[model samples]
Target: MLDDYGLIRVAEREAAYRYAVVAPQCPADLMWPDIRQSTLSILDAVIKKHAIDKGRVFLTGFSMGGNGVWDLAAKTNGIFAAAAPIAGWYNKDEAVHLTSIPIWAFHCEEDDVVPITETESMVQALTDHKGSPRFTRYQGFGHQHSVMYETYSNPALYTWFERNRIDS
Candidate 1:
């Protein structure tokens, strides 16, 4: 998975979605942090380089990358319009500080790698603070299924993302 080979397949599909998949020349263990920093850097560069609407910027990920989405979005505060963390996990305490932005979480009930409890606990913490987040759990799906693929394939997900804009 550390190899960027699979991303080529995603790029080939295109599917009307624009993505900037970054691959840092680092060890596998460092990829997560690299992705986090690079994503922010890319967004900063894009905002400065083009006529960015600002309100339309979004962050999303799957599995380990899903955890990255939560971490990055939470850290950025008002920078991202919305976040969709698929089968991700994060510290519940950190989640409280993320009430400013909307989050849509996806998880598979049969997920064994991260456990569905992780997402449920995070969602509970977020909702307990009156945070508005949408969560959908695939009944029989397992951890291996690609949540991002499922998310992108569903038109409703794109529509939902398009509806929300960052309110600063």
Candidate 2:
């Protein structure tokens, strides 16, 4: 699925490793904790098995996965160096937890599956909390796979990742 989704290409171009965790199928009310644990476990497994630069770890995802990026980075404390949540949304109250993390959010103005306002509200919440998050809003694209393709393919995202990290 990662190859089909072009994550392999993203990893190769960034010279970074990307791990995708598959969560057990469940309803939304019961999903967040499991997803959070799965993400942390993957991080632990990768750090244990590879030469990972602990400080440069970043999180990104599209659609539902993008929602996961937002939730995980906000709740997981210092684990992620930065987060890029594409076409995703989260509780605006949780924005307080994200104030310290670097975020680069993306959404399409004509998104059909997930409304662009979801991302707009998040970015706004972050801003209200005095967080400086970069946002990329595209035109003529609905909330489809092409958005992720364009986002992951852009070299600027990787360069931005390089510029942000958890200060040890």
Clash pairs detected, candidate 1? none
Query: Could you say which candidate leads in TM-score?
Result: 2
Model 2 gets an lDDT of: 0.81
* Best-matching candidate per lDDT: 2
Q: What is the C-alpha RMSD of each candidate to the true structure, in Å?
A: 3.3, 3.0
**What tens-digit string does per-residue lDDT give for candidate 1 at 65-126?**
77777788777777888888888899888877878888989888888798988889889989
User: What is the Cα-based lDDT of residue 1 in candidate 1?
Assistant: 55
Clash pairs, candidate 2, are: none
